[model samples]
Each structure stands twice: as C-alpha cells, then as structure tokens.
Target: MKRNLSSFAHPVCATLAVGALAVLSGCSSSAPLFLSDGRATTLVQCPVGSDSCSQQASASCGGAYDVVRQSSASGTLSLIYACRAK
Candidate 1:
C-alpha cells in the first residue's frame, strides 16, 4: 500500500532549517571585524554628561577608525575603535 509522505516532510524540513539557522547564527562573531589590524587598538571613554558620548568617541579616533563597540558604566561611556588602511 502507498503511504502519504507530505505530513512527515514538512516537520522534518522545518526542524532542519531551524537547526541550520541556529548553528549559523552561533558561528557569527559578536563583534564584527572593522580593520585589517586583526585587533582593536584604540579605546576612548566619554563622560555621561554629554548627550553625544558615542559620537564624541567616534570622532576621537581622528576620523581614521570606525567605532566597533560602545558601552557605559560608572557614568562613563567607552568605545572600541578600529582603523582600516586606505
């Protein structure tokens, strides 16, 4: 007797797709690469008094690097910047 395969097909495919997505997401880096230097070299800290702390940090890199991360603690904002060669 012939049996229907559609019901089993959908759930299995959905399960496999979800699993693949999960694995791929986990493989992604939390902090993406911003420079060819292979590491973040410049760090800047901005006081919380300024509304543009993040902007200030980005500018502090002397227009050469891109800000890759920003964090705040103890009323101070911190940034990690990476410079890429032209």
Candidate 2:
C-alpha cells in the first residue's frame, strides 16, 4: 500500500518555518547585554552611514556612551556601545 507522504511533509515544513522565525526573533540587535561594570550595553544596527545608531545610543544612555566597537557589514552599520555614567 502506498502512503501519502505529501500531507506529512506539509506539517513538518510548516513547523520548521515557524521554529526558524521564532528563533530569529530573539536574535534582534535591540536586546541589551550587561557589561562587567553593570553598565547596559547593546548592539545598535541601522542603515549604513545613518545617524540612527548614534541617536539610539544617546537615547539609550540618556546622554552619552562609549563605543565598544563599530563595524559595517552587508550594507548595515553596527555599533556596540555601553552607557556612560551620569
């Protein structure tokens, strides 16, 4: 007897797609990581050459911040910053 494998494949494919999306959602750059000094740090991603990253850093720190690192990749600008003291 031949079984219908197509029907089984649909559910498996859908489950995998949903799982991938869920995992990707958590990979957002907006999520902040804590520094050893208890300062809040995060990777800010924005359009290449845009001031959005700096703006976000300032807002996140409420004024100034230190750039731990900066790089541009795949037409995206990224800045790793830690909030500065008040």
Candidate 3:
C-alpha cells in the first residue's frame, strides 16, 4: 500500500516559515533590551563645555528616558539613564 504525503506538506511548510520569521525577527536590533524591573538603560558620553552634550545624550536615550545622573571627568560628560514609559 502506498501512503500519501501531500496532506502533511502544507502544515510542515507553514510551520517552518513561521519558525524562520520568528528567528529572523529575534535577531533585529530595533528591539530594546529591558531590565528585569521593566526599565531600559544605556550610557551616553559627550564632550564637556558643549551645549549640545545634554541634548545629544537625551536623544541617545531614545528621547523617552530621563537623565538619572550626569558626571564629568577630563573633557567628557557622561549620562546614566532610564526610560520613562507612559
């Protein structure tokens, strides 16, 4: 007796396609990495004595987070931050 295989092919193909899409999407950098407490954080450095330093740092924090700390050393200013969600 010969067994038919076409009936199972579509589901297998669809499953593979979905699995591939999930894997590909997981590799994207657009997604933010959040901490266990649901906050996202990053470090930003800028040149001291520049008015744009704070602006650039805020932009680097994705424009939603607040500047938690600001420090300067040598000629650079550093910003530590966490995102503020609505």
Best by TM-score: 2
For model 3, the superposed segments whose C-alpha errors exceed 4 Å read 1-37, 60-64
- Tens-place lDDT per residue, model 2, 4-80, is 99979989999999999999999886646788888877888999979999999999888989998899999999999
Error of 3 at 66 (Å): 1.5
Tens digits of per-residue lDDT, candidate 1, 1-86, equal 67599878999999999999999999996665445667555666778667464565456555565667778899997877676445
User: What C-alpha RMSD separates each model from the true structure?
Assistant: 8.8, 4.4, 7.6
Q: In candidate 2, how many Å is residue 71 off?
A: 0.9
Note the Cα lDDT for every prediction shown: 0.70, 0.90, 0.75
Q: Which stretches of candidate 2 lie over 4 Å from their true place?
A: 1-32
The lDDT ranking, best first, is: 2, 3, 1
Candidate No. with top lDDT: 2
Each candidate: how many clashes? 0, 0, 0
Candidate 1's TM-score reads 0.39
lDDT computed for candidate 2? 0.90
